[model samples]
Target: MKFDLHVHTRFSKDSDADIDAIILHAKKNGLDGFAVCDHDVTGGGPFSVQRAAELGSDLVIIPGVEISTSEGHLLVLGIKESIEPGLSPAETILRARAQDAVVILPHPFKLTSHGIGYIAGLDVDAVEVLNSRCLTDGPNNKACAAATSLGIAQVGGSDCHVPEMVGISYTEIDVQERSLDAVLDAIRQGKVRPGGGKTPKVFVMRQMMKNAQKRTAKILGLD
Candidate 1:
């Protein structure tokens, strides 16, 4: 099955894609499932799954969270409780693993997002080698190199903040079942392939402008 392993929803504060639109676009993109890795939040899991059911859609919404670790960002799937942010990457991975979660290094070379540079020595379960949000190939290629050098699993996702961007990048995994656990296990076992083109430059600019406007509104108490 194909899954966009990293994505965001309104719960992230920096994102605006609602559960309904996320499901709609995932189906439109021919995806079998997706994970909502809301930044520093872990409450979107059951909500997204329930909403998909309500819409009569069979898309699997995996429970996941994107942790803002002190070193960088980490996407952990198959875990529900929110791990406190700012933990070192190793500590974060330990906590996620305690829950049998799949730990993924997202945009591991993007400086602005705090991509930690030494993932090849970390105990991560996977590396996001194809993030749609990465404009230049440098970051993505660097991630790929690290994954290759370290023999870590590789995956991809849109890391999208808006509905239209969902599934712009994804992972093709080998799973015998269509359940969440099956997908997570597949990723952890390295039975996955990264796939996706870069997100359009226009969409990237639009997201940046939107974020800027939101920040301004919040500062002026107009949000």
Candidate 2:
């Protein structure tokens, strides 16, 4: 099954994408499943899963959250509740594992929030080698190379905050069962491949501009 393992929704302070709209778009775009890894929150997970099941009927919604650690961002998947943020990446990964969750290093070289600086020895299940929202392929290449050198599994996600970007990058999980736990097992067993094309430059640039605007607002205490 195809899964875009990273996304955000209205629950994220940086996103306003309606949960319903994102699932609909994912269906229209031909994705079988996706994870809603909103920044620092999973409050919308149950609602998004319920709404998508009602709409698509067979689509899968893997409860997930993109958490901010002292080191950087981590995608914690297959967990139902929010994992506290601001812990060191080591502690964060350990906690996620305590919940039987899967951890992925997302956009490990994408700079600032998207970058995790150095993850040389962190015990993570996968590295996000392809994040469609990256400004260029250089960051993706760096991530892919690092994963190769580290001999760890590599995956992909859109890291999207908008609907149209949902499946621009995804991971093809080789699981016949199509259940949440099965998918997590697929990731853990490295039965996955990073798939999908680049996001449209226009859309990528637009999102970048939006992030810049939000950052500016935050700096000025306007958000």
Measured against the true structure, the TM-scores of the candidates, in listed sequence, are 0.96, 0.93
User: Clashes per prediction?
Assistant: 0, 0
- RMSD per model, one decimal: 1.2, 1.7
User: Candidate 1, after superposition: displacement of residue 165 in Å?
Assistant: 1.5
TM-score of candidate 1 versus the correct structure, residues matched by position:
0.96
Instruction: For residues 64-121, write the lDDT of model 2, one tens digit per residue.
Output: 9999998789999988567888999999998999899999999999885558965589
lDDT (0 to 1) per candidate? 0.89, 0.87
Q: What TM-score should be assigned to candidate 2?
A: 0.93
Best by TM-score: 1
Over the stretch 125-194, how does candidate 1's per-residue lDDT look in tens digits?
A: 8899999988799999988997898899999999988888889999999997988888887887899999
Superposition-based RMSD of candidate 1 using all C-alpha atoms, in angstroms: 1.2
Please report how far candidate 1 places residue 144 from its true position, in Å: 0.6
Candidate 1 backbone collisions, by pair: none
